[model samples]
Target: MKKTLLFNILFYFVIISFLYSAGETSFNFLKISQGARQSGLGEAFTGVADDVNAIYWNPAGLAQLTRQQVCLLHSVWLVDVNYEYLAYAIPVIGVGTFGIYGTFLAGHITITDENPVTGQYIITDDIARASDINITLAYAKKLSEIVGDNSVFSDMYAGLNINITMENIYEDTGNGFGTNLGILYYPRYQNYSFGLMILNAGIASERPTLPFAIKLGFGYRFSFENILSPFTDEGYYKFSENDSALAIDLIYYPIEQTTKANFGAEKYWNLNKFHSVAVRLGYKFGSDLGLLAGLTVGAGYRLTLNENFQFDFDYAFVPYGDLGESHRISITGKMFGPAETNYFENKEEAVKYYKEGYELLYNKKYAEAILKFSESLKRYKNYAQAYMGMGACFLRLGKKETAKKVYELALQNDPNNQKLKEFIESTKWDIK
Candidate 1:
């Protein structure tokens, strides 16, 4: 069934869009970062573009999602202005992923007139109301799936976003359309990501300006407890999402001939399987805003509601020096269930210990790793990999005889595993 959809008409449609014209964009509101997390990172999310917010920073990140997600954000922007943002993402098992997000901002404009005699500006009775709305639809998929050749491009993802925008200033109202192209690459190295995006390249009959720009970004994760390990769970859930990461983005605006950079760091701590907390800090240099104004900080907490649902709350603060201060709040919801139900809950629990053991092994804590592997095996007698891992740990500890015995036991349970046979044959161990 999945293969049949691969050849569907939807797979053949390719949208490649880029615009490099030089001009001022009218819907400047579109340039504001959408989510609190992203904003706290100085909008450097082009690389670390995970979660539903990916729909705005780098749509290609949608390919990395394993389930359905939704997000809502509200920002008290500079100069007494405010905006609301909403985003949703859906991952289709066979057809790729789809996303939608919208940003809305409204404010009243104060009108003033200069008195000729006094040469002083006076507030007038007339005030103008202004508002802006931006909505985007996005799609993303692994390049291998789209091309039907996974051998080479398996780790490459591509995405596109269609932009719909409207701006109202006093009596002049305008509507515009645009496109964004993005790619996210996961190389052979783990926990490293590279991304690029070109966005908002279209024309408006009345506005005539688009915030056409490009972003090149990189992200790296630092992990110690298998947290945010970039590893998936049960082929359905996430197991290693507790970790810290650094992100950088080089942004270029063609119209303004300006280039800026964003640097950010974030850390996540998983209290258990059901709860997590995170903190973030960021700086944007070369922004017209002063150093103090370009600094941002944020924090978040996530609670797993159940097997299939999750919720997160986030807040961010930014000071714009004398201009004003900004405060933002965001809420995110996600739906993803483990592949196994109560019937295999034990097996799922076993995997947790197994991963902990593997990380211990990687960190050269052979004794600790053996204990964890033993705990995993206790949950499921037939888990061949746990037995194998235990054997490896014993070998690292120079207990060759015990290692051999464990390997033999694993082969007994998984008789057809050729890798185990080869592993045993290749090891040089003696049982005197």
Candidate 2:
């Protein structure tokens, strides 16, 4: 009886936290871990992104990349805390780029009720399940007009993100929506960059509370090898492309009733196409101070039979004192384009499904939209639009399982799609 009472109290707090859009206590875990490659270097991700994971750190960096890539990360922390992150970046044909991201944190806890009368370890009636998940869809576009023809300034890129966030505690569940914006600026002649972004800015619901915060950082790349410099009569000719680059960054963030500043640096060495290594070091300062360090070991190789097909592997390690440590690993298989040109694969397929499903749902064809979205899933199982459509359809159909799964998948792909999460819960309990 006492255990049940204690659990009931804790359950009440969890439910209250969500409904009130409370601080990290209830859904704080939703904060995604830094990219595996970046985190392994000690949470220095804010300044060291080169691939799909760039979406999470600095979307502007996407402008510096020339290929299409996909990455997935999984990690286990102390006390059974589990985390997962995924990203896909596609360089568009003349248009720019887009990235999709998702992150999840889950853990279990037992709530025990102690009887004041019995004064002993008694029955435990409450099992607590905690999870924070979000899905994000982001697009970054280079403004050629804004940054044209400057040898020292290559281009400026802007990105926008839509997110779905959700949480559950025993009998009570709450959901919300959020948004993020990012900008990238790189010099045409340099390997360094400056970035700015705002994350998790918005309200929990219609009232429009919980404003946004900003993060700004500058990074410089340093390289020991004169890989980009040419050997000339003078012994060495220097250029931005000829030398390995070293990078450093300073970042500021306001969140969870606290403000934080971080500084870090990374060094990259190009051993060969089949091997490369980077070392990252950073410091996070806030109400608590912690050191972040990461090491990345990467390898890329071409298949003998198919030059177009290439394989890449990356591993990273990140540790936080009170939060424990995170380890991330990813592998990629991609097919090169014509003459090594940049292009996004399966884009029309993604857009088509989204358009068709949106039309049907808006037209009140919930059932038809469900079918269309499920079909879309068959084509792009990683697409968040289809999952979102499915979730909306399930809401209309009064099917909780479909709604839950669809919302979960949507959140996995976008990690910032809070609307879907809120709708899933409200629809489940018939809450307004």
Candidate 3:
């Protein structure tokens, strides 16, 4: 089935490339970015595509989603044009994730026509309307599920997007079809990802070819906790829960024969478990238009409605040099079903025990700390930090061999942790 799908995608691309080369393309609206979060990031979103907006950035990112999501975006462009986008995504149990999205760009213009016989210009109507609309259906699946536990294909995802587009300009109308192929790779136990996409592989019989392009990108996330231990040697631990991500994308436009590079960074602060605020900044380079069209900034807020529901709002500001500035806003909602249950009955209770364990360990109460860490693990079996605390308790109790074993278990749960690896190696001599 996979082979057949691959063949069909290639065949479609070949046919579309031929048709696109034979026709003159005119629908530039297809190249416009939609989601406010992505637009704020200089459209460098292919690698950080984690929300419903992934339908437009890289559909393969849908594989990372575990719940259903809906997103809406509205933007006011230069010359009074209005652009809007809507997207919804849902996961299908063991199969994969499916998404549907639509983008519309509309504007009003003055129209005039010349009389054939009199050779005189005549105004048929004072106002004329023009619009472009695109609708897409996409699917993404993890290759690990199909290929089994093979290391090479694990954490890899493939996706396909099919789009139908219509353009209307005064008396002229055009229709087209396009496809996007994308892949995303998330290494096991790592907070980074890589992505590649071939976008707008299609042609219109009556219009010019779509804005065909290829994009390659990567993203990395940094997480921080407990940053203020040195400020006050008090027993109280000050923790700042935050995450920051950096993303870069290189895009090649085939028709324009140009390449553009986009860079973006975002920092998120979690006020609590249920709310967060994010600041974003980005820059674009190698734009055919000019160098000044590179700066972008944006912000976002997320609110958790319940264990199963969340809402997100994002805004972006983009300047187009002399043309003007563009502002975009997007709202998204996510719903998690029963299948996506929380790991603990009460996360606060587990965290309390974990923190107590750490405090006991700091006070040199090894036996008591071991019991507290074990209790924490009973509430959250997959807590790697709790395992680390247990290992530390064992080390303080002079059970180096046991400590080495506990640390190794922690490494199993968090395979990509460099600090954990170093700690384990340092304890190797103690194991004997």
lDDT of each: 0.77, 0.57, 0.77
lDDT of 3 by residue, 71-117 (tens): 99999766567789999999997899999999987776555565666
lDDT of 2 by residue, 212-250 (tens): 556666666533554433332111112222223334444
The TM-score that candidate 2 achieves is 0.61
Candidate 1: tens digits of C-alpha lDDT, residues 1-432 = 111111111111110011112335567667778889888887888987878899999999888887789999999865456689999999888899999999988766456666766767666666766678899999999787766644677677899999999877666789999999999986532468899999886777687677888999998875646543233221111123327888999999878788889898888888898898999999988745467877999999989878788888999997766656789999998887432111122687689999999999999998788778866765666788888888888888787877888898789889999989998999889778
Where is model 3 more than 4 Å wrong at Cα? Answer: 1-24, 112-125, 224-242, 338-432
Candidate 1 residue spans exceeding 4 A from truth: 1-23, 110-125, 187-189, 224-242, 336-432
lDDT score for candidate 3 against the true structure: 0.77
| Each prediction's RMSD to truth | 13.2, 25.0, 12.2
Clashes of each: 5, 37, 3
Q: What C-alpha lDDT does candidate 2 achieve relative to the native structure?
A: 0.57
State in Å the error of residue 336, model 1: 4.5
